[model samples]
Target: MARLKKTVAMVGMMGAGKTAVGSAVARALRVPFLDSDEEIVKAANSTIAEIFERDGEPFFRARETEVLGRLLRGTPCVLSTGGGAYLAESNRRLISEAGVAVWLRADIDLLWQRVRHKTTRPLLRTDNPRETLRKIYEARVPLYGLADIVVDSCPDLSVEEMAGRVIEALRQRPDVLEGE
Candidate 1:
C-alpha cells in the first residue's frame, strides 16, 4: 500500500477556532475531520474534564499522545488537536514528523469573547480567566509558532476564509508534498 499524504493538523491556544476552522478545511479538502479532543472522549468513553478528574491531567495527556499517534498513522486528514496537546514534546515531534501543523493565531480579546461562555475547558477553570489565558498564551504562543504555518484567527475571517488560508499555506509547504 502507498503511504498517505501528510495530514493537516491545526494547533493553537484554546478558543483559537481549531474545530470550526478544521471542519471547514476538511470539507474543502473532502477528507475526514478528526478532533483529538472528541476522539479522546470516544476512546475513553468520557468527557475531557472527567478524564482529567479520574486519571489526572498527566494520564489524560498520555491518552492524547496515544490517540494522536494512531490518528497520524492513518491516512491524511484534517486534525484539530486539543489546546494542551502540543505542550508535550512527543506530541509536537509526532506532528512535525507526520504532517503540517497550522497555528491559528487569535488575539486574547477575541479568545476571551469566544471562550467566556464555555465551561468545558479544563484549564480555563480559574479564579481569573483572563490571567489564565494570558499565562497559557504566553507559554504556548512561542510553541505554536514552531508550526509549519500560522493563520490569523481574526474575527473577520469566516470559517471558509480560514480554511482557504490553510489550504493556501499547505500548498506552500514543500515538506507536505507527499501526494500530488
Candidate 2:
C-alpha cells in the first residue's frame, strides 16, 4: 500500500467525479474515504436538496465548512468535497494547510453531460441547467487552478482510470504521497 502523508482532497466543479474517483483512489491507497457533502447530510439528517430548500445555501455552506475543517484535521485519507467548497477562501486555506488539493479538471460539456439528468444538484435546478453549469464552471475554474495538483478528466476515462490519474499526480508531490 502507498503511504499517504496527507489527506488527498478532491475539489472541482459538480459532475467532475470527485466522489467516485476519490473512492477509487482511497481503495488503491488502502485508506479511508470521506465526503464532505455526505457528512453534512448525516449531521443535518437531511438530503442536500432538502437542506438547500429548507435551511438555504448559506446554512449548508456553514455546515460544509465546519465538516471540511474537522475532516482535514483528521487522519490522512481521500476527502471529496462539494462543488462549492473550494470557492471559499477559508476552506481553501484549511485544505492547503492540512491536505493536498487536486482539481479534477473536466470540460464544461463533459460536466454538463454527467450532471444534466441528475436531479440531486440543487445549484443546477434552473430553467436552463446546461447554461447554468457552464456559468458555474467558468466561475470556478480559476479557484480550482489554485490546487496543489491537477488531474484532467476525459469522457473516455473510466472511474478507475481517473483515480489512477489522480494517484499519478499525487506521486509527483513526494511530500503528499510516499513509501509506495
Q: lDDT for model 2, please.
A: 0.94
**lDDT, candidate 1, 69-166, per-residue tens:** 99998889999999988888899999988887889999889998999889998888999988998998898888888888898887988889988887
Q: What is the lDDT of residue 64 in candidate 1?
A: 95
**Which pairs of residues collide in candidate 2?**
none
For candidate 1, the per-residue lDDT at 54 reads 88
Q: On a 0 to 100 scale, what is the lDDT of residue 125 in model 1?
A: 90
Question: Residue 49: error of model 2 in Å?
Answer: 0.8
Cα lDDT tens digits for candidate 2, 1-180: 679999999999999999999999999999999999999989989999999999899999999999999999999999999999999999999999999999999998889888988999999999988988989988999999999999999889899998999999899988999967
- lDDT for model 1 comes to 0.87
Please report the candidate that would top lDDT against the real structure. Answer: 2
Question: Once model 2 is optimally superposed onto the true structure by TM-score, how far is the C-alpha of residue 168 displaced, in angstroms?
Answer: 0.9
